[model samples]
Target: MASKFQGFPGMDDILPGEIEKWQWVEERARAFFEAGGFKEIRTPILEPTELFVRSIGQSSDIVHKEMFSFKDRGERDMTMRPEMTASVARAVIERGLLTQAKSLRLYYVGPMFRAERPQAGRKRQFHQIGAEIINENEASDFDAIALVHGLLHYTGLKEFSLNLNDLGDEESRKKVKTALADYFEKEKNRLCKDCRWRLEKNVLRIFDCKIAECQPVIEKAPWEQFAPLGANFRKLTAKLADYGIPCKVNRRLVRGLDYYNGVVFEITASGLGAQNAVAGGGRYDNLYQDLGGAAVPCTGFSIGFERLLTAIQAQDEKAFEEIRTRRVYLAPLEDCAAVLNVVRETALRLREKGFRIEMSPGVFSLSQHLKKADKLGARYALIAGLDEVSRGKLVVKDLAKREQAEIEPEKITACFEQ
Candidate 1:
């Protein structure tokens, strides 16, 4: 026997039976963003390897350890994007999108490649749905937060918590960096090997340490004293209350990215294990300047599409109960030589008239057709056989109601009428 093949270990296939859930989430997100004046942006999956190094920071985990990098035949270094924000910034600069408008509200939904160690939900290839508000000031921070809140609500997520933090401006962050470095330097011997390196390379990364040994040192750091929520951050949180979006100020919630400054946030849900954050983003005012462009203050957030789906399913699978609503499973129950043509035509007409149809590939008996239809969760089955063709009518079987009626082709809409 020949050897069988399967997907790469850390990559999961979005198989057919489960794809409807993804479609539902994507549809809701697009509708939510479009209504909020955001246009969708599609960027290449691969970029110059240096783009991530400069934008995400060489000391950050994504650039330092996670990126999938390679060189093309032309001897140019390239890498699959581990995240989209950097790629979006590159597009804005390259295409002069900013020149067309003062600011851009761009959203994206796509796969990102990372070499993360495979876990229950973490994968080498994962999806994210993110949006950015570029060339906007810190005031637009509230709008970004509200957009995320509104999106979660619109997507049928019932329970999730917003986590807020202020990394402060560049000047303030420099001060905090020094303070954190000084505090961690004293506890250097107690730090884990990774934290020890982070202390010297990028001190803020010490807070991201998951090793239990580093917790005490991290917790004792006087973060608030050095990097207090500035007056602008306070006003933004007040706006959160005015708009009734509840959030917790998590002082320890600094994200893993180095580009983040000013306001940063994460939204977490319960179903996911230790890595429960479903979405996170913050203001990266200097990322543009870091990547050969002017300093463009941009605030954006990306939702982990897999985690978001998992959370929604865990809370209420009912959100997708109606995914098959108005769907018709088309069956050809007559002779393959004679009835298949008419059945194919009918399927086409119904689809053209705006019906979600599933057509059988081969001729099957009525019972077999009905069984498949039921398994597919179709609301109705349109049966086409030699008898119905001769009679100039088609049999419409109500899969759920267990009723059948012979109706003319033009009257297809009547069968669905409640």
Candidate 2:
């Protein structure tokens, strides 16, 4: 078997050194979500097939094309979640989280699998950070948008704009979608094959088509003209403006997911070719009740983590510093076993004190250890040998400045404070 330990096709690993940027973004997300009163929630990655089909709609692209479906040992059909909202809805209702609370605001961050093409950011198993606010006023929709805006701004994501549009309330959208059916009925040859199939199933997807030829046709289409804004929808948009967030009214902004019922919006950053939607979400006013739970209004958004990260890098190549695990390394002379043990113990103590420590695995020459420390990007190298160990002292050298100092071993912690 040719040493088959390769990663699954279309999936890749998050290598160790590349995690600093992810850590920074995740920390900011945790802080922002906490400040907004949205507690964290984790649901199982595997969900029943019916959960998605019932909520995301069978005709939608996610359900029809991208879902990773399989059968369990008991022969029950199951699917790895392609998106989080439906699973969150099912979990919320099944766990009865909504029964006791007047409102539930939850945020989730985890992997979602979809069998899509391997592109710059669209992976088969990619991660997403999302939030959901259920059982609240329509105002919560704007609040969700504001929260997303705050994260983007806080993370230094510039050169982006939020496209806001209401799918209209469920009833209003039905009226508009029904009214436009005949208008596009005879234009089958004019639209792309995907748009043609979607015309009857999800007319909104035609507007979101990425095909260059289909773009002009959808652009000229009259769908936006017919989608009217109701009072609730107008108030939501107004509230977003009052918060100092600039939003453009894009009538053609229909998300591919079926669960998005009321307001649908997406954030796009310029220069992210083909996969430009950095984040998106919408109001699923009836999704909770439709999934056999109490009627609750909910709205949320998700950051396409990989896509957004790529966009940031493309715009600013030097944004991320080189990855290094250690800020300091301790080197002990090759012949000094006892001194090596003391140095190792000191390194462990520094780590427990929240300092990043690095060292050679076994004893090595002083020159070799210093070379390794420099390569590993260690700023300070602490040296201890037979002489220092006997005296209970250490020789600290600054790699950048080529400066050295003799310090008592007990006072090593002071170096970090300085």
Candidate 3:
């Protein structure tokens, strides 16, 4: 095969049957975000290369190895965004959204790029539904946590848990890192290559290592040896516990991004195999200021759309039947011109009434057309032919009941409304 014809190795084509799950999840996310006071934001797929390096951290795997960076034809450095938070932070600051109000809550749903070995639930190009709340106080953090809890409950997952951790403010982190640095320096040779790299860049990230080889060494190693929380961080943790969020002192849970400074967390399921992290996020107090905006505090979380679907499907066999049955396929016979016109008009009216309709203009024979409707699992088939056109009426077939009825063309949209 030629290189031009081959898609990038880790990306996937979302075929017809696969997209319905995505649409269902997206609709649910929109409804949930709106109820939580988050407005939607759209960002460009391409970004300046420096955004990831400065915001995600140059030493992290995302920037150091996974980013799809290239020079445009004009020799300008550009990269496909590996995550949405940085771009969102830049937009919030550049637009001066914070100046208008004390806080900003925004959500985004889009594709993210990263070069990696594609595994189950892990793709080079994947989609994420993420939200960010900026310039908030203690109440905002609690709200963010509550929203995350509510979202998972709404998603209908029975076997998942949220892992929560509080990353202390910079002053306390400095004291902690100093202690851990001494410990890591002595056990430096025993640490994995990735952990060694993380030690110099962000020691907190070393706790997130998934390498089986590094597990034993990390298990015995004291997390407090590297970092400890300040008094303020402890108070925030206690407050979360008071709200019954079921948080624990998980020193091992840390975010991959460098911008996160407090309250890092993730959601996981048992059935997701080695890649158990299905969703995660944390607070980024310095992100706005680092991205050249005024100093502000923000926190949010993201759910991996594909991974969440995988877990749902694995747990429940019948979860997708409702989504797959939401269409009314329109099949027209003779009077190709007039029949097609009726089909188009009918579809528009039905769609306006909030019904999903599929059209088949090329199908000719009534038998073949009805079969098409059945194959698509259409709830109803709107049939129009020369006979119906002559009478100015439409034949509606209830594919589910195998019954037929005649209705005036103008009244077709009312059929599904019942």
Using TM-score as the measure, the top candidate is 1
**Which parts of model 3 have CA positions greater than 4 angstroms off?**
1-4, 153-156, 224-249, 336-338, 352-354, 386-393, 406-418
Candidate 3 at 360: error in angstroms?
A: 2.4
lDDT per model vs. reference: 0.88, 0.81, 0.80
- By TM-score rank, best first, the candidates go 1, 3, 2
Q: Give residue 395's lDDT in candidate 3 (0 to 100).
A: 90
The best-first sequence of candidates by lDDT reads: 1, 2, 3
**Candidate 3: how large is its RMSD?**
3.0
Per-residue lDDT over 1-418 for candidate 2, one digit per residue giving the tens place of the 0 to 100 score: 6865889877878875566678667777888899878899998999999999889888788887899999999999999999999988898899888777988889988999999987776899998999998888777888888888888877657778999877777777888777667666766678888888889787776776788777766776676577767777788778878878888988788888877877888999966887789999988888877788877888989988887777777777765542232368888874566887788778877776545677777878888999999887787899988887888788988887899988887777767666
Instruction: Provide the TM-score for each candidate, comma-separated.
Output: 0.91, 0.86, 0.89
Candidate 3's TM-score reads 0.89
lDDT of 1 at 132: 97
Clashes of 1: 0
* Residue 306, candidate 2: alpha-carbon lDDT: 83
Model 3: per-residue Cα lDDT over 75-104, one tens digit each: 989999999999998887778787888888
Question: Which pairs clash in model 2?
Answer: none
Cα error, residue 151 of model 2, in Å, equals 1.3
